[model samples]
Target: MAALCPNDFKPIGWLCRKKRYSLKWKLCISMIFVLMTSMWINPKLLMSMLTPVSEYKKQDITPVKNSKHLMVSAFKDHRINGSTRIISILNRGQLQPLFCIFCCGKNNYSTPATIDMHSDHFGFRYVTTDVLCRNKPKSNAMYVTLSLKPDVLYNLTDFLPIQNQIQEEEAFPYEFTICISSLFGSYNNVLQFVQTMEVYKLLGIQRVVIYNTSCGPDLEKVLHYYSEEGILEIVQWPIDQFLIPSRGWNFKEHGGDIHYYGQLTTLNECIYRNMYKSRYVLLNDIDEIIMPYQHANLHLLLEDLQQEHPNVGVFIIENHIFPKTQFDNSGQFNRTEWKKVPGINILEHVYREPDRKNVFNPTKILANPRQVVQTSVHSVLKNYGQTFRVPPDVCRIVHVRVPLQSNLTKEQLFVDKKLWEFEKPLLPNVDNVFKKTGFLN
Candidate 1:
């Protein structure tokens, strides 16, 4: 062999020097090679691997403790003013501090919430409260979670998706939506429910939103029927599961934790839930129907009333009681097919009790939801415009239930068959529902 020089072993020397590089540099080169190979194999797989995990991972936070004392119901984004309104039920006397934690991708921003207990708590321990949180600029938060501490871990609270963020104008999904809140006591009343629903259709009501805690089997069938028809939306209201709900409105008399099965809370929730969806929202019970005496349909009645009271947002209609005990003399609507139904026949009860002299008669409401901030069973607590008491001749709610004035006789009551005016269309519609639901087989 020829005499060996350093030049003869140059390739092996180069390889040895390259191996002397730092481990970090070696790993970097290896990663680059793997990434390039992955890209050639599947670009989407490489892109997904490079993307942040937070972008696709669903965040599930633990539900807060002591939810009964301070239960969060819903989150609404008040797009009109760019603020968030948190619907919650809190102890009226509770002094615990609450914070609104806004979730923005991987980060969270906390803000002190201004708790506004609704004035119509009715002396109950728990009340409907509005926890208002102002949106922070550039937070880009789409959901909110409630916590007692300002610096809560993102995984410690349940996230509520913010709703009602879309601002709608003239176009709306429903012209009139009837809101029946917190149906409890295993409410059945199949015949009356069907009658009322058909009457609502006659009155031009396009939607009926009911917060149901519990109902009997017959009523459930009726609810399912209307829901399948796309005319009713049932919101599951398991208030009793969370708190001791009262049977009556007054806390002292009713003797329970929350007033009237959290009726006020459901009413206000319905208002906000349907704010941008419905043009008008009528807050009343299933047994009561806002019957118009003068106009053929509710649309015309509202059209004229809105024209007259251009600045008014709420129109309070007097509630007249049609005692279920008294029936029409003719018994014209007491059809044999309906006798088996387990509810009062509203059509048969035509005589309404005379309005008590110099006493405050509780009224139901028909309001422009866009103008209402909060609502109660009888009236709107906070509104953007004037509240007008609609004339009795124009409209009134036909409330058929246990008589408030039980002393009145049939002869003493007024003969107001306003419901009969709707019988032509109402009866057949109700019959069809009953037939379809097999209530009358």
Candidate 2:
């Protein structure tokens, strides 16, 4: 028999073996397609039947109540409008916001933020509160494992496997400098303090400006030493050069909080207006230390914040006071051997609820300084958009403000018992915590 042609009407190749069987098979396939099409017409019913069913609906946390007028949970154990364990911060009138607080995590993305992933590789849409309530979608495992990585992994993975020429400029993330002005107090170490200054240098910190404002000469000496060592710029508002009354930098003594803060405001406005424009400015006293993990510096954090949300200013800090007690006029900072690294006792305090003990005086400075015009009681006076707070682990700017090394010394803090003896009763107990401290009694 002659071999059948490839497209013979008699059937060939795939249809060659058995005409009867092939016809039956085609008939069945066509019938199945028709059935599928009919089922698809009522797709939800089909999905209910054919999709793998989970017995239990995934539990999403209770959605945040009143997101627009964000209510940072009244400090833990402190009820809103009721309990008084921690002071309730009520937004009185159309007052300017101090810092935008968020509980974050799951509920954050539950209400899909209208995003444009392609336009800028990062964008946020103006979504009305009602829109958030209506179109929120449930997220699943695939969304996280396969999706979120595209932006971060693209640059981090470096794509060395395929081609090495990916332009770093197009990388979603970019580096920015975080200038920390670690001033020295009377209690300091010359060699060791310089070594501590080296941490910022190692993490690709391009510039470090130390406000060598010390009551004694130790910190100034260290700054001078580091200045020669090419790690820092030593500038001092010496005890002699103070802006306000005598010893203006002593914030904890003799109503220094007010004077020191005023001085900080003047200095910030001056420097921010003059010499340089930094992307992230941290307004911390010498006691504040901003430590980030895995060498993921400030630029990296800001890039992530910018990626997650478009615009933001200052990052409010949650201060953790150490030793879990009132002032310790003991245990001075003693450095015996020269060149020995100054040991910092990371006095881990009792862990309180995050929103509680992690006290945020919104005014704690960290920001694009030029963007802000002035500052009020823990509030930033800004010229533009709203400020948003991010997770602390992403940025832990620690404040070691109380019972400082100075408290351990013989030199009385400018608290001058003689001067305050008469006016003690008249001083304002502005904050409840301050009222309790009695320094303003």
Candidate 3:
């Protein structure tokens, strides 16, 4: 043919002609045909093939590293300023060059983080630390990766979503919230836990945040019930999976890696977690209740206190141990229905031990979380404003547990019936919870 038209030419026929195409060219044509066929069948296959492997990994969040020497629990965007606060538990006295790699899709902004080990680690080998990273200007970072090198693509912790950006003092979702740190030891104190929750409700507590490492089945059911009711937020804290946690506060005697199940970390995390959510956060144990003696409810108590002591961030309430061993002779709250419960009935324990002579009594806190920087079990370590120690007559934590004053007879204990004031509402509320959780059924 003098000039063959393009439509009359057949590439496949030409390739099939003997010795018309080399082996290399034939293989290349076959690959091109297969690829084009595949693309025609599914266009997405070509896109996936073209995409880099590293880009595929960005789809799923990596599992948080707990087994590492430095364990990060949560990453929060500090509302006071556009900074990143990484709540972590790390080995004490072990220096490491930790960097915060802020991830914004494919790009990362690496910055040096100031590692501040909590002063209240109590000499534990493992301590809670706050890794602070200053935010880069005009950065839209979404996730943070803590690593020795800035090029780390793993161990990323997504910033906790801020439900409310509280710019005004009056813009809090909850007026009062309770923070109970690291509940462990298969804590089956169902009765006390319920009682405390009821007491919290009566005291105007809108929410309770419990960091639970472990609990019994019965307590788990109660937790679930309260969680469904929107009163309790149970945070799953598997601290033991990360490090050797001590049951006792002192590391020398307890001989564990971390102090009291990384309680300091949980407390601080709770504070920051609820900083924009709650107006005041009460840091106490499940066995304790921050009872307001002078006021009708906690709101009223706080209102009066805040008015009197303006600019006070922390209000330290003295903890008074109401011995479980000794009960009120009246037995007014000794209901027969609660006999089957697996925990101490707090209503019956009203006799609080007298404050020891020349000894510092341990206290709990009701704090303005936004004003706090760092906290210990009993008090705030760092805060923006003043600290007010509330008089015992005004408010105190009614702790129902073992007798702190073992030597003192029951008669010597002070008869503080502050908890009894809410017995009317507390009883019915607790009974309702029991019925719903199938404890009574």
Q: Local distance difference test, per candidate? A: 0.81, 0.34, 0.79
Point out where model 2 deviates above 4 Å.
Answer: 1-192, 213-215, 238-258, 270-277, 293-295, 324-363, 376-378, 400-441
Question: What TM-scores do the predictions have?
Answer: 0.85, 0.40, 0.84
TM-score of 3: 0.84
Residues 259-343 of candidate 1 have per-residue lDDT tens digits of 8988888888888888889999999988889989889889999999989999998999999899999999997998999988888
Candidate topping lDDT: 1
Candidate ranking (TM-score, best to worst): 1, 3, 2
Per-residue lDDT tens digits for candidate 3, residues 108-205, read 67898788888888888777778787767777565565677666653343322222223456788899999998789999999998988888888799
Worst 10 residues of 3 by lDDT: 58-67
**Model 2 C-alpha lDDT per residue in residues 68-108, reported as the tens digit of each score:** 12110111110112111111112123222222121122232
Clashing pairs in model 3, backbone N/Cα/C closer than 3 A? none
Regarding TM-score, does 1 or 2 come out ahead?
1
Q: How accurate is candidate 3 locally (lDDT)?
A: 0.79
Maximum-TM-score candidate: 1
The TM-score that candidate 2 achieves is 0.40
